[model samples]
Target chain A: AAADDLAFHEFEEAANLLAETPDAATTSQSDKLTSQEHVAVVVGSGIGYGAEGEEEDDKTSLLQDEKPQPRFWTFDYYQSFFDVDTSQVLDRIKGSLLPHPGHNFVRHHLRNRPDLYGPFWICATLAFVLAVTGNLTLVLAQRRDPSIHYSPQFHKVTIAGITIYCYAWLVPLALWGFLRWRQGTRERMGLYTFLETVCVYGYSLFVFIPTVVLWLIPVQWLQWLFGALALALSAAGLVFTLWPVVREDTRLVAAALLSIVVLLHALLALGCKLYFFQPLPLDHVVPAPQAIPPSPNVLLPSSVQPMTTF
Target chain B: AEAEDSPGEQEATSSKPLFAGLSDVSISQDIPIEGEITIPSGTRAQECDSSTLNESIRRTIMRDLKAVGRKFMHVLYPRKSNTLLRDWDLWGPLILCVSLALMLQKSSVEGKRDGGSPEFAEVFVIIWFGAVTITLNSKLLGGNISFFQSLCVLGYCVLPLNIAMLICRLLLLAGQGPINFMIRLFVVLVMFAWSVIASTAFLADCQPPNRKALAVYPVFLFYFVVSWMILTFTP
Candidate 1:
């Protein structure tokens, strides 16, 4: 009787400890033990655990055992018993113990390690500089110089128009940059690749624009053909590069169709211009300006003097 | 003895399942004796407290709302849905309508037709012109407009003309020629102004041409004037 009293006192103390503790493992183990004891009671009866006759007997026994197990036993039982919640606790522990999620893990690991981060930024900056400078040079070279001579006013207007038109092309490039930056995950690399392709092509459009405009002005077939071929190759390259990344069939199909149409239009325009308007010097129709006029007059002078000798 | 009796009251208190986690057997067997128990419906084991369930649901709703809010904010504030509309489909119809109106007037005058009365052919011509202009405009500028800007352009440009035309037609039915003509001219000028503003805005930032392209506004005005003369003077 004294031993039983001592056991009961120890059990009460354990129960108090469990209730006060916030650890998930202890609580989960207690639940598992309670469930196991209930199962044992049901199994102990003459009827099978699932048998209808055993259910009533099991219920009666469960009710009798409803008095909470001694706190210490409950805590010990819970701690010893493994169940669903145990798996959850294990998972949490495993996750916390392991490295963090992607990119974040790398970032955290490198937080104090500036040496590791430096190369990445340097490479990125170099790439950015190369891309920007190369594009700007390409754009400047493609622009028609206004100093050449014949239709000076027209040339000035053309230059102005082309400059203004370039703004629209910026939108697509900006969109590509934004998308690439936003979707940084490896799984989304295809999307980023696609955006990059778009950006490259969009910039290429600036080169293409001057060529197309020049072709249109002279209505030259060969220039048109050459332009068309360039366009087709660029488009095909873009599609091929992006095919791996873009998952949507509809978008792929649409892109293909658009490319085909553009190619065909370029081809047809070239053919007609070359075949129909043969040997016409495109430059002859619009003479190159002799020189770029001093800055364009802010307001057309009221005197109405013809500004050019042309 | 008292400790033993304690179990009895507990038994009374919890006649229900203590840990109802896997009570399918007990449910299927014990329920029928209560009276032809159809499968105990909608009985889920409640391991979590009500507060946890409520908190989870609240968190889920808040998460969804936050996501939706972020998307909405992007569209409204930063992305500028309005600009998208203006550059795309919205401007197309307005351009089409104006072009068609001008084209019809030109064709009618070229054909030497009396312009005093409205003819079905003239109406058809107007609509067809409108459609062509819409197509060309869309082709050129569709990528420029945001969805919201398209809506604004449609409201400011297309809707007013339609309303004015409808009102003019109604006035004509009451045999009010002067009033109808005045309304028509007012609507036309307003439409013309809208076109000028829109086109100027569009072209202002356009890249410089390889050659001096004709000033767009003047060209458009000239076309309109020629069409008006043909329609008004041809008999």
Candidate 2:
């Protein structure tokens, strides 16, 4: 009964909106932006709560009845995005971890309510984990042999934090902008909010958590195996989630976008593994030999003292 | 949607009367004050029995200590009850976090030649930082709980990890061996899972139905990181 009531109210509201602005249905993306109120309602109901809104007609008829108010720059407006619960988050994490062959994660799990919490904390956790584990691996290596001069590289924490955070946050922002720009030219392309894009990238890092632990093993092949596994899982999740959005573009553009995403992800995992977990340099392995006598050209303390006495 | 909105309305209505009743009681009780003024000796006798300064102080202290201890017991055997939530306190969590950090500090100092104070601070910061971030995440996820309640649960769940850290420290005394390392690994892994289970059990009810996995993942990660630290303690 409630769903029926909501649907009736949505139908009535959308009809009124269409009657008020007869040309809204036919406007381009640029004109849609100028018509902020119309776009806000459409985006809120059509994309924000799109789980049951499959058809374009149904989408236009649906409304985000849950939004208390639609005004941006209000705390309440932003609060709605944070208003998710545990099971949904866990489901999203699982979606990212195990990519279904044909399924789109954004459509399946996160279409209705994409969130920023996962993206922020997942990146933060990954950064700290990498830094700490990387240092621990170094310490373990140093312990295996006593001659190596090892110091705690505190800078790795800062560097890791910056690199991972920038990749997670800025890359998504840039991707969202690029997609939006492309969306203007190509009306057939699927629309994605910035939050969904960031959410996908954030959850993709989950595979790296266990992989870093595996990297602690000193074996070269095992470390590489862990890195490759992490790279493939993360990239697969990203590609599967994003393919629907990019598929409508030219084949060249679509392939370019996917390759860039996968390449960036691969680089993050491979770079961290190689830079943070590499073996000690050869110089650190063997100490300078202590038995060598002083060269004849070099004056010893005793020789200098005899000359001073004369 | 109406069903969801109804509870919120009910809560608002339910809270309204309690405030009205409080004011009503205060007004009605005022009449007794004048009556009591005429019977000062009797009132003084009642006050003597209830409000002797030292006795009241000791009683309050005992009550607080018992509250903290009961919370610890609940943490050890987490169940779907409101006891932890209703009377949430940070005393137990503070103690556990401090002790866990201390254990980490002692082990690292013994293992490394230059185990400075930063190691201790690092563990301390990581724990409190993780707890605060998780609590904030839960809040952002629209959890129907208070901030401190979430923090208390996350903190108390570290008890198992603290025990694991203690066990690892003892095993290290026997010298490093493959068998000892395996045993330590097993202990840390078991305790890590225990921490996750206990925390999720406490937190499961507060999370929204579809988003339970989201809230639980962070709890898992937080415990896993601590467990990793315990497992890798070389000394």
Candidate 3:
């Protein structure tokens, strides 16, 4: 009776331990059996167990015929039950212990995955190529020709124009295309990108319109108007794109003031040209040529004159 | 002992007279205001023929005196004044344009944020371009060279041009951040360098006489390439 009672207690403890364990596979199967029991029991417990007789009978008969199982035994049940060593079981439990919780998270996330090298390579390659080609062309040109010197004025204007245009137009389009390709859908363009495009194209207009208008139109006033418009638009575009990134407000205000000054200079230049460049009347500027120093004989009396010419 | 010490002290206190020995050797070195003092009748001025010798000596003395006076003047008025007097012609425009460029960059960047002005950058761009064009045209006309030759020659001018621009910017834009200054300088240098190089390469192989004409085109080519690159790459 004591042996039977101990065996029953052991089985009950084993079942409770299994139910409490949080292993995914064990919990799922156990939940499945419990739901099955509830459905069977709702109809009628005795009828449900009797109707599920074949499966239940096989499990029960197997358990009854088996020898009394040892408590806290090894999973190797086929071996002699008497040979179960408690020390070996304890050693196995100790062997499966885990480290502190936060340690593994750092190891998994931070230390692995060395995959950024490729992207860096691509960026470096592109930057180097562009820089080399651009710089080489400029250097070689200057070297071969003593005259083609890159003046500060030229450098400032061209660099500003080119840098602005690139930042405004090219980078955005490339970004947009990259995103479209990557996501397989169009994304709303960034604000800066739009501003950059406007600024670049607007500035280009500033360059082109004046060139065209000044060349094509004889009227200085119309050309001035076109030039003014171009300048305004270009400045507006630049400000729109750059203002967000600037840390100081004073500089922004100063830039606006400087623009006014530049416009004034332009106006002054135009005024000078208009005032000084009037068409000259030819007759007054070029006196008619007299006969080559009237021959020396012509100045003297005809009697003393040489016979060579009249 | 005290009397001897007194003499020694007096001797130490007073400096030896510099011309002491020459006092009795004057021999009428000073001219008389009246009729010149006569030597012996046999040794008359005409007999000695000393007028030419006197005139030459006077000239030598005058020249030496003038040279010494100049030396003293130079020592007294050294030429180290900090006035903006020298080379204002070159410096003024350079300083003005650089300050303007820096201001434009700053303003454009700011205006980009606050959404106020758009014309600031455009005006600067035009001014710079105008300056370049005027310089190129003037150099060409004055040098009696063709446009291409001007460009070829101008291509070599990029380095000095950038150095001047940088110096100007440094003087004018002193309060700005180092990083900002460096970046601006870098971009300017690269663009100028590249354009000048390309212009030179293109114009170098072009045939003589006209080869000089090809110089300016490199600058123009640099402008073209940089503009295209910026248009194509920047954003």
- Assess each prediction's global lDDT (C-alpha) against the native: 0.35, 0.70, 0.34
For model 1, how does the per-residue alpha-carbon lDDT over A288-310 read when each residue is reduced to its tens digit?
23232331322223323232221
Q: Put down candidate 2 lDDT per residue, A207-276, tens digits, no spaces.
A: 8988898888776556666677778888998998888889999999999999998988876775676566
lDDT of 3 by residue, A1-310 (tens): 9999986775554444334321111111123445433332322322222343243434333332333443455322312211212232222222212222232211221111111111122222222233333333333344445454321122223333443344434544653344335334324322233323332232222232223324233333454455455445444443333333221334554366345434443443233222221112211222212221232221113323221121
- Which candidate would rank higher by lDDT, 1 or 3? 1
lDDT of 2 by residue, B53-73 (tens): 424677777877899888877
DockQ of 1: 0.01
Off by over 4 Å in 2: A1-53, A56-61, A70-79, A82-109, A128-162, A177-191, A206-263, A281-310, B1-62, B79-81, B106-118, B170-175
lDDT of 3 by residue, B133-160 (tens): 5344333222233443332233223333
User: Superposing all C-alpha atoms, what RMSD in Å does each candidate have to the true structure?
Assistant: 28.9, 13.6, 37.9
Each candidate's DockQ:
0.01, 0.18, 0.01
lDDT of 1 by residue, B194-228 (tens): 54454334432331231012223232432343223
Q: Which is the better candidate, 1 or 2, if ranked by lDDT? A: 2
Worst ten-residue run, lDDT, model 3 chain A? A109-118
